[model samples]
Target chain A: MNIYFFKISTLLYFLATMVYSVYLILLKDDLLRWASRTVLLGFVIHTLAFLSRYVEAGYTPVTNLHESLSFFAWMIIGVLLIAGLRYRIKMLGSFLTPIALILMLFALALPKEILPLAPVLRSFWHPFHVIFAFLGNAFFTLAFCCGVMYLIQEHQLKSKRMGAIGKRLPSLKVLDDLNYYSLKFGFPLLTLGIITGAVWAEYAWGRYWGWDPKETWSLITWFLYAALLHQRLTVGWRGRKAALMAILGFIAVLFTFLGVNLLLPGLHAYSNW
Target chain B: MKEKLNLGLKLNMEIIVIGLNHKTAPINIRERLAFQDSEIEEALRRIRSIPSIRETMILSTCNRVEIYATSKDIEKAVQELKQFLSEIHRFPLERFERNLYLLIGEEAVRHIFRVASSLDSMVVGEPQILGQIKEAYQRANESKASGVILHRLLHRAFHVAKRVRTETKISNHAVSVSSVAVELAQRIFGTLEDRVVFLVGAGEMIELAARHLVSGGVKKILVTNRTYERALTLAREFQGEAFPFGEMSVGLKKADIVISATNSPEPILTSEQMIRVMKERKHRPIFFIDIADPRDIEPEVGDLENVYLYNIDDLQKVALENLKDREKEAERAEGIVREEVERFVRWYQSLEVTPTIVALRKKFEEIRVRELEKMLSLHPELTEKERKSLEAMTSAIINKILHEPITHLKEKDEEAMADFYIDALQTLFQLPQSSEVAKEEEDARI
Candidate 1:
């Protein structure tokens, strides 16, 4: 039943993405309220489905590829709701919902059979490693969305084309600020996650740093964000460059979280697909 | 009383709007014609006393001053209102005649809807005109200068404005530079709702920017200027903290957004200062809006990561973009106004049958009650309960008898049919020709 609810929530999110897309296209203010509300409703049902999975698994739900993808989608939306309320950028959802919907769809398409919890994955440090990592990735995803919006809005302004999309998107300052905040929020959490993962690795595998593909990619993602933050601090590198870097950071996070688990053979690999 | 009520939706009734707007008149002329709130009641009273001007509403604003009145003769009402305008300001009619525009009947209604919808504003989609119109109507209503005609028209206009506001994209984005600055800050920080804004100058543009930030929900403000006294005064004005000019670096490090509009010969903030500030603040993103004429901040400051700097020219560019967006949305708003105008015209048509409906009901009640009383006198054996039931039965019968005709009369685009029903009801039932209804309404008003 919870899985069914999850599927339903994915469909709702897809529809919400469509609604926000239309709102962005038409610059319709009324559609924004409905779009946000639809996402909120989907988020609520998605939480129920996610929590139920935790109940069933007797652990954090993000154990495998399918669980990770779904959990990532869930966490991104959880952050989106909080950030959306904070930013009040209805147009941000237009860019964010599709990414979330795509993630949910990918998760739904993956294997549904519950994998038995591996003895290594059952360590207490596993939850900390997963939650902070997921949250960090979620913040990066927000940065990616805002970065995309910043580029679009900046292009619109520079190109002298104040079209519907340009008008709907928030200003560059707003996007950059949110982008910076996301990096700040996500980077530390990501560091904590990597540290926890190292501890968990040492406990289960007797090695703290194995140079596994997941660990390597996670380090790469961390470096990308570090560079982004460093450039931002030292040089005040904002606007398009910052936005692009934030987007790059998310791409790195995606590789670290999903690509490593799927294609690269490593100790961190939990699922074949 | 009969003359006052003559300006209904019935035949020969006309609504006339005589006004000077921003486009038609200079600011000097517009301001002269504008009515203060204290003067609105007296003006409405005086205008109502003008012959053929049965109802009057004066909408006075900085951008325009309009007089909306109703009469049986549009030309005479127009002349009276024009004369009133000329006489009140002691200006000759010919002097201001060239600056006034007049619309009669349906055109007047459409003009009102467009004005209420802000499509007719000097800056298209501005929000102040609707409130001004409402206040004008309120004054007219309090003075009893607005009877049924003005009441329906103004009420429908308010509704149309609301519809245009909600249903269209007329007032979605901020077009002003100060507002756009605030808007950009919001986009960057996610919200100014909890952010602290540092105002880095004491210029009019900077004051405007500070106001925008405060209104946008900035929780605290920091004011600094080259002159400490001015900074203290400006900070006191904003109810914010004032810091010494030398502490600007500290202020920059703490502030989320900095708006600089100071009169400086050269750039007040350079790239080096920003780098230090960014480092000190741990590289948190800070938004800088340099609205000063000579540009208070160095242009290269924007090149830094996490520093979003918008010079006045850049803000102007954004403002221009937003204005274009507003113009595009204004087209959509105009369509909404057109739709509302047509709807209101139909409603006005249906409204023509209302008096006859009222009279018809009154005639039926008179006959039913007379018969009921006569029957009770003839047969005193009728119980109070039975009498009450008979009253209910008669009222129900009358309602049922009138339902179909009333519904048919209220349908859209049936003005001629409404006239026909109105005349038939008046002639067949020998209903009083709305003069009695007018007197009754007037009596009720008293």
Candidate 2:
């Protein structure tokens, strides 16, 4: 039943991705609303599936490869839904929906089997760390989307080719501010996530910092974002530079989350599923 | 029969329009012929009194003063309209005769559709022409000058205008310098709602540009002129501050966008001066619009990292680009207007057809009734039930025989072919011109 929910959720994400792709080609009001609704429905089914897995496995369900990818996909949708409600930027869905769908599809390709929890995974700090990391990554994902929109809009403004395709993008200033906002909220959550992981590292491995592959990459990702935020806040660096930094920040985050766990060998990479 | 057919041909309704527009005449002549709002009702009243005119409407916009009317005598109607224009405006008829262009029938209908859709405007795809035509239609309707033909035609014009607007991108881009500035501001800032704009000089062009920016929702406005009192008055009108000309750099630092239209011979702000202001403002983006003929800002200022300076010629280039875009879109708008004209003409030609078919059937029924009465009197010995069946059989035969001809008359593709068919029917069956004859009767009674 839980797998059925996950399959349905993944199917909805696929359909929404198709609609959003069509919307990118030709912007329409109905297509956008339908895509958002599809994302929301997929989000609900995904939440239900996670809860069912938690009830059966007696854990938060982020301990496996499939769970981690699925959780990342869910967080992307959760953050998008909130941003979509607040910003109401119609074209944002046209960019982000495909990303969410591909993430979920890759998750579904992995084994769906829920294994017994490891003894070391049993700790209070573990859930907080994973939760905050997912939230931070989710916002960074949105900031990445805004950064792409900002560059496109800025190019349109500078080029003076005020035509149909140029009209589809949001204003450069709006996209820049949204990029700043996501970074502002996501940075603190990332800090809390890193702090929680450090506190939990002491409980599980008898160390405050392990210099593990995931840990080292996460610190690099954190520093990348710190530079981005600091340049934006202090130097008032904006437009092309701010947008490029957001894009780079998200790349580092992607490496920290997926590349470190799946490829590099480390203590934290043991639960590769 | 030939004489009666000639009478029916003379009674046929015709639509005609005679006017001089921007294309046909200079602005001086167009303004001279233009009608004031107060004079429209009186003009309509006098024009309707002309012997040949049946329905009349006048569209007197700045670009054109067109009189649209339907009548039986197209030549006489045109002559009457010409005389009416000359008499009312007291302008010599010979002076404007070369400028006036005349269209009749389907050509006139197409002209109206083009006008209503703004394709006939000086600036093609402008929206104001449609509104002006609507107001003219409303005035005609209220004055009871427009009748059946005009009511249908003007309503079709409005519908065509709506289709052109929704289906075409003709009005999508700004074509003027001031509007281009507003558009550029929107492209840069995403919105002008909370941005500050500073006016460097009080030239008329700058005021026009400032008006466009203010309406676009610029948060604050600062007016600076060499004459401080003039600046104060203009600022009071805009509900903004009148800053000192000595503190232009201070004003520039506070501004997000600046419009300069000064007549100054020397460059007001060079690239070096702007770089200093950029430092003071932490390198926030600034836009400069130099709309004066003698440019206000140094051209080198545009090379600054976050400063976008557009001179008058550059703005004109952008406006030209936008105009080209609109011209491309106008192809689609023209297609819409053509489609609408075809549909309206089809419906209008169909209007005359149904009446002709009905009148032909009426003529046939009259003959059948007369013959039936004569036969019934001759067969006085027959039973009532037999008489009823006989009458029904004759009626069915008449309906069957007349159906093909009626269908043939109603199915004509071209107006000329329809007229030929209508003329044939009137000659073969002598279908009386009921409406025209009734109008004559009313004329006699009055």
Candidate 3:
């Protein structure tokens, strides 16, 4: 049942991505509305899928590669829907929806069978750590999209070429503000996720500070965002510099989330696929 | 049958448009001929009071002055309207007569449509002409100077203008230098609200761009000029702060958008100076509009991380490009105007009493001829002369029977009543309905 719902939501997200792509080209308000509504519907069904998965597994669903990727995509869409309610940036979805769709597609390609939770994975801190970490990643994904848009728009303005794409993009101030907001929210969540992971590590392994590949990469990603946020608050770093940093920070996020597990043997790499 | 029907009676009342536009006249001549807003109602009344003119409306704008009227004699009405213009403005007839264009009937209708749709504007597809025309029409309506023909014609003109606006991209892009500046600024800042504008000189072009920004919702304006007094005066006008020319960099530091138009011989704001200012402003985006001939800002400032600089030539190029775009869309707008003109002409033709009368007579004549032919066949021995006499007698009888109602339909007085009579006669006699007329009648009812 959870698989069916997940497949349906992935299809809806695909449809929403296609609509947003056309909306970017046509620049029609009605198409944007339709795209946003489709995304909201997809997010709702995706939540249902997550809840069913949690029920079927009798635990949180971030236990393997498939469940984690799916949860990450779901978190991204959930953050996007909440952000949509707050901001009037119509073209943000045109950039962000495709990322979520790609993540869902990657999740769908992985194994779907539910398995019993391993004894070591069973802990109260595990779900809280995964949730906080994935939520942080989701907000960083938003910042990354805003950063890319800011670069395109800023380049167009700097070059004094008011092309079609430049006209559709939001202002530099708005994109920068969104980036800052994402950082403000994501940074705290990231700090919490790190703390919760440490607490869970003590219970699962025996030491609170293990320099496993995932743990080391997560620290590196944390330091990158920390430096960005520090500079933003101190020297008033914004516009191109800030946008570039946000984009760079998201790259570190991707590596910490996926790269550490795929290439390196880590204590967290229990996918066994 | 078509020719015979057309020859039954003449439709003497014709739509005549007489005017001079920017293309045909110099500004001096156009100004002399233009009707002031307060005097327009009087001018409309005076024109409508002419014996030949039945209904009239006058449209006078900065670019054109046009008189749209329905008249029995086009030549006489055109001559009188020209005379009226000379008398009202107290200008000599011979001076501006050559600039006048006289369009009659369908040509006049098409010209009015084109004008209302902004196709005939100096800057084609500018929206101000439509609003001007609507105001002119309202004055005509208020003064009771325009009757059925002008009323319907102006309504159709407004409709055509609306269609052109929606169905074409003619008015989408800004075509003037000042407007294009604002457009680029909006593209940069999204909304101009709470954004500060710095004006760095005192000139007409600078003032125009500043006014556009003010209307665009810029939060504050900072004025700096070579003469501190001039800066203070301009600043007072915009309700903004005034800074001496020496403090321009100070104003630049706070400004999100700067428009500089000074008569300086060399670049005033160099890249090195702007680079310093960029840091002071923390590299926030700043738009520089250099309207001066010798550029006020250095060309290299545009290369700065977040500074957008556009000189006079660059702004003109964008405006010219937008003009070219409007021209491309103007073709589609012209097609819309052409289609609407045809529809309006059909409705106008339906207003003519001659066509319906001719149709009614032809219907009677057809029946008369059919019955006469059957009788002649029965009386095979009848002579050719007798058949000719019989045909003449039947035609005479038909004319006698149709004379009263035809005359009533042809009545020039009370045009609204005439329209009613024409519709009723067409429906009562089951005459062939012009589809356009039917649609118009349905629209009228609605």
Candidate 4:
């Protein structure tokens, strides 16, 4: 049942992506409403799928490549829906829906069997760790979208070519503010995620500190975002510089989430496939 | 009966437009003819009193003075309107006669639609003409100078204008230098609310640019000039703060947007000064608009990481590009106007008494012939004379039943009352509507 709901949600997300693409080209308000509504519906069904999977697997489902990737996509869409309520940036979906769809497709291609929970993963802190980590990554995803928009708008202004694409984008100040908001929220969630992982590691492996690949990469990603936040607060590194830094930090996030898991060997390499 | 109905359609009242625009007349002549707001009611009343004119509206702006009216005699109406313009302005008819244009029938309708859509504007896609036209229309309506025809025509014109606005990109770009400057400021700063605008000198162009910024919601204005007294005078006019020339760097550090139009021979704001200000302001993106002749801000300042600089030539280039874009979009806008004109003309024709009466007669005749044939066929023993008598009797009864309503519909002297009667008759008898009339007209024309 959970798989069926997941498949249905993936299809709905695909529909949303197509709608958003049309909205971007036509710049129609009705199409944007349709796109946002479709995303909301898909998010609802996706949440049900997650809950159903938790019931079926008797555990939090972030234990493998497939489950974690799907969870990340779900969190991204959830964050986008929440952000949509706060900001009138309709074009954000045009940038975000594709990313979410690609993540869903990647998850769909991986293994789907409900394996038994490993002994090391049977701790109370595991679910909190995964949820905090994915939520932080979701916020960073929003920052990355805002960063890209800021660069495009800034370039359009600097070059003095206020064309259709430039007119459709939100102003530079709005994008920069969104980027700052994402950093302010994402950095703390990320810190808590790391702390929770450390506490869970001590319970599971009898050690709080480990030179694991995921751990080291996560630390590097955390430091990048921390530096960006600090500079944004003190030196007021904003506009183009802040946009570029946000982009760079998200790349670090992607590497820590995917690259380290796939390419490096570690105790946290639960995706045996 | 068919011939009479066709004649009625031919004698339908025509819409006539007569005017002189910027293209046709010089500013002196236009000024002479333009109607002030207080004088518009009197002008409309006098124009409506013309014997041949039925309903009227006057649109008077700096660029053009046009009178829109419906009349039975187009030529007489046109002559009277011209004579009224000459007499009211105390100008000789021969002086501006060559500048006048006379448009009648479908041409007049198309002209009004084009004007309302801004396709006929001095700047093709400027939005001011529509508001001016709406205000003129309101004044005419309030004075009761416009009746059914002008009312319907103006409303349709408004609809066409709205369609052109949304369906085309005609009005999306800012095509003036000051507007372009404001647009760039908005793109950099999002909302201009609480943003500070610093003026380097009290030049006309700089003052115009500052006025546009203030209207765009910039709350604070700072003025600086080589002479403190001049700066103080300009600042007081803007309800802002003035600074001495030596203190410009302080204003620059606090400002989000700066407009420099100094008469200095050399650049006053170099890259070094801007770099220090950027540090002091913490790199919160600042925009510089340099409209000065010798350029008050150095060109290298534009290359700074978060600094956006546009000079007079750069602003002009963007405005020119936007104007070209509007011209391209104007073609699409004209197509929309053409489509709407055809639609409005169709609706206008459908309200004619001839078509409705003709359709009603045709419907009654068809029903009478069908019933008579059924009765005659039922009695195969009936004589030829008997069948003819029955047909005549049915025709007489049908004509008696239709006579009162058709006469009342034709007797309506008010166009609005006539329209209501036609609409009620069409609904009561389920008459074939506008499409058939439009098709028949198209066939007749071909």
lDDT for A240 in candidate 3 is 88
lDDT of 3 by residue, B1-446 (tens): 23444533445578888899999999999988888888987787788788888788888999999888888777888888888989999999999999999999889999999998999988888889989988988888898877766777887887788778877778877878888898889877878998999999988888899999888888799999999999999999999999989988889889999999899999998999988998888777899999998888899999887788999888888888778878888998889878877877776666557788777887898899899989999998999999899999999999999988876665555443565566567667767645545555455434
TM-score of chain A of each: 0.96, 0.97, 0.98, 0.98
| C-alpha lDDT (0 to 100) for residue B266 of candidate 4 | 96
Q: List DockQ for all candidates.
A: 0.20, 0.41, 0.41, 0.82
lDDT of 3 by residue, A1-273 (tens): 999999999999999999999987766677988898899899889999999998998999998888888899998988888887888788888888899999899889988899888988899999999999999999999999999999998887666566767777887878888999999999999999999999999998989998998899999989999998888777668888889999999999998888887888979878535
Judged by TM-score, which candidate is best? 4
lDDT of 2 by residue, B105-222 (tens): 8999999999998888998888899889989999999999997678778877877788788777777788998888888887677789889889998878878888899889886889
Candidate 4 Cα errors over 4 Å, as ranges: B1-9, B37-42, B88-91, B138-144, B348-354, B362-397, B406-430, B433-446
Which predicted model would earn the best DockQ? Answer: 4
lDDT of 1 by residue, B29-92 (tens): 8877878888888888898788777778888888888999877777777888888888887878
- The predicted structure with the larger TM-score, 1 or 2, is 2
Each candidate: RMSD: 9.2, 8.5, 7.4, 4.6
* TM-score, prediction 3: 0.81
Q: For all the models shown, what interface RMSD does each have? A: 4.9, 1.8, 1.7, 0.9
lDDT of 4 by residue, A46-143 (tens): 99999999999999998888898899999999889988889888799998889999989988888888899999899999889988998999999999
Fraction of reference contacts reproduced per prediction?
0.33, 0.45, 0.53, 0.90
TM-score on 0 to 1 scale for chain A of candidate 3:
0.98
lDDT tens per residue, model 1, A166-223: 6557767678889999999999999999999999999999989999898999999999
